[model samples]
Target: MLYRLMKYVLLGPLLRLFWPAKVTGLENIPAEGGAILASNHLAVADSFFMPLRVPRRVTFPAKQEYFTEKGVKGTLKKWFFTGVGQFPIDRSGGSAAQAALDTAIRLVREGHLLGIYPEGTRSPDGRLYKGKTGVARIALEARAPVIPVAMVGTDKVNPIGSRMWRPRRLEIHFGKPLDFSRYEGLSGDRFVERSITDEIMYALMELSGQEYVDIYAAKAKELLAAEAAGARPAVPAQTSGARDAARLPESKAG
Candidate 1:
């Protein structure tokens, strides 16, 4: 297919010539099987560079907005992602999240290599953030192994505002797979899911060597943007009497 041709025949050689990289831990990857490649997302190029390093094809969930943009650029992006076997799904709605998870589970069952960024979004400051539980959910639900990967120096290759990738010294490190087989049938337990997700994040932190921040990347970006805009931080609602020491008096019945 065109995807294989692009990955192995066409683009593969071109990348070797222009974007040569040192990839380690290939032995950690199964020659053939369903597994999750969970990694710290540094830049947009992580999507392409990660898959390009592995001999096996990787499929990742993409934002629907990427495929729905309103211009020739959007069309090209849609075509590229589609041709590379990436599919877009809604990420905001609860039902849509479940739908995307189901799609991932199906891919795992089909023995496809699934690449996931537990951080859910690119790190705004290149620091590793707490991972979302979706990775754990997918791994547990599909009974697949999760491999922690680290992409080094990719942000420099394709940093924010960069339209195209510039040649850089990129490295791909694949760590040992984290097995969650003991948590079988516990996917419905949120605490279990969190524990699994946290374990995966720990592995990523060790592999990536990036400073760890106990917050989601997207939320951290929001806070940074809010601070930049000089917006007042919202106050939490008072839920207890002690928290309502300055509460207004209630009106008596007239």
Candidate 2:
């Protein structure tokens, strides 16, 4: 299969040679059955290194545009992304978002390892952002365990705006699988979902040692941009969680 070929023969070996990733607590990955590998989003390369280090095929939902283009260039892109173990999902909100969530649920139910970024988007700064509850919903709906993963040093290798990857050491720390079995059959409860999401984010914060920010990463990006443009933007309502109180860092050029 293309996945195996790229992982073993084509891309994996080459990446390992250059980036030299070291993994800790890899035994935390289940040998079989469904589970969610929830990680903090730092840089684009988080997607590349995480999957290469894991034994099983890890699938992430990519923007639908990655797979929907036409012509030779589009065809090549579609092939490349598919070979690299990504599938298309509509990220637009409403029904389209629900449909993507449904697809994620179905993947886990079918005994696949679903790689998800609970933060929804990469951190604009290096701080951990508030997680979206989608990961909790998937775990509850599929009745699967959530394994918190922290990818370290990737932001240095592929910084926020860099098109090229630098040779830097990578570390993947896998935390113990979090069981939400007590919340079984409570998938639709928003409060329960938020609680689970917060727990996951706290674990990530501990593992990666990144400062926690209460605002969503996308919103943080908007604020950073607004500040860059010399505009005073309205600060969003902040969450009251313990980690949420961690002050947002001053914006810097990436």
Candidate 3:
């Protein structure tokens, strides 16, 4: 309906005309079934170019702000995102991560191609940053395969602060599907989740050829913002009653 109409009639031609993708290993995409497409986010257009080029309709969670504006323009923005199969979600608050995980698991279980930026946000400087464990949690909970996808040169079309998209060539590459069934039923194990996330990230790095940064993108952004403000980044508060898997020994991961 709306998805097909946009792709076949409206945005498909425009996207291809402006920033056509030279994709490789698209056969890696499963013909039919639930799977997580875990990609490295480098540009705002990664959302656009991705769904446009893929044969199947892909849905990703977008920021709630995109749907909350109070005007005709805001209405249109909401329409466009909804038309293209995207839904809005709040990206803040303490429960946000759990909410997102729940949404992703639901989507995958319902047999939709869920596109997730494992980095959680766009790369601040084109370097592939550490993936959060939420992706692994979703994959394990949904019992779905996670496919590592890489979109290259998208930053040039839609850089961090650029208002207008500049036409540029882009490349999309899909790596082999990563199965985490060996660690099935262990979604609650943060160490195991970290292992799964790291494995997917390793494949993404190889496909995108971006420098790898082992820290989360959000943390990196916080550090950069703090530095610009002439303030040292605030250290994270320790959990009162939760075990920090980061401090756990590797041998105990099993």
Candidate 4:
């Protein structure tokens, strides 16, 4: 199949030759079974390098834009993402968001390795942001363990605005599998989900050595963009009290 061809024959060799990984804790990955690999998104290359180093096939729910763009470049991008076994999901909230979560849960239940960025998107300033609860929801629904993964120095290889990837040494750290079986059957409980998400984010923060920010990555990006446009950035809401968890919507773009 195309996935094997890319991983074994085509793209794998090329990636290993250029951006070799200094991987640790790979043995943490279960030999066979469903699990969620929750990682902090630094660069787009995090998607490429992590899966290349892992032994099992990993599927990620990518933004639908990757598959819907028009023209030849878009065509090739669609082919590459599909060949690597990624599924496209709409990031737009509402029913689309639920559908995305459903797809992820179904995949996990079918015993597939699912890669998810718990922060919902790449960090805007290299700090770990608050995680969306969808990851916890999926893990609880599928009764799967969640592994915290960290990718270091990926931003240098694929800088935010650069199109070309420069060769750089990479480090991948896999933490111990986190089991939430204690909260079984509480997938939709908002407070429970928030607690689970915070635990996962804390694990990632410790593993990645990134400063933890109480705000979401998407909101950080919005503020950064506003500042760049010479406009007043919207004030970030307080996240200290219990009201913070209660106010967060169930889903976000991940």
Top candidate, metric lDDT: 4
Task: Assess every candidate by TM-score.
Answer: 0.86, 0.92, 0.88, 0.89
Clashing pairs in 3: none
Kindly indicate the candidate among 2 and 3 with the higher lDDT. Answer: 2
Across 56-117, the per-residue lDDT of candidate 1 in tens digits comes to 88898899998999799999889888767688999888999999989998999899999999
The count of backbone overlaps in candidate 1 is 0
CA lDDT, every model vs. true structure:
0.82, 0.86, 0.83, 0.87
lDDT accuracy of residue 58 in candidate 1:
89
Give per-residue CA lDDT, model 2, range 1-254, as digits (tens).
99899899999999999999789988999998899999998899998899998889999999999998999999988988999899999878799999999999999999999999999999887778899999999999999999999989999999988999999998999999988887787889887787778888888888888877777888888898998898966445343552542221111101
User: Model 1 lDDT vs. the true structure?
Assistant: 0.82
> Tens-digit lDDT track for model 3 on 1-254?
98898988999888998787899877888898899999999998898888787789899999999999989999999999998889888878869857877998999999999999989898887878878888889999999998889999999889999999999999999889988887778989877888777778877877887877777889988887887798976333322211233233334545
Inter-residue clash pairs, candidate 2: none
Displacement of residue 145 (Cα, Å) in model 1 is 0.5
Best by TM-score: 2
Candidate 1 C-alpha error for residue 59, in Å: 0.7
The parts of candidate 2 lying over 4 Å away from their true place are 233-254
The true-versus-predicted C-alpha distance at residue 175 of model 3, in Å, is 0.9
Error of 2 at 103 (Å): 0.6
Report the poorest 10 consecutive residues by lDDT, candidate 2. Answer: 245-254
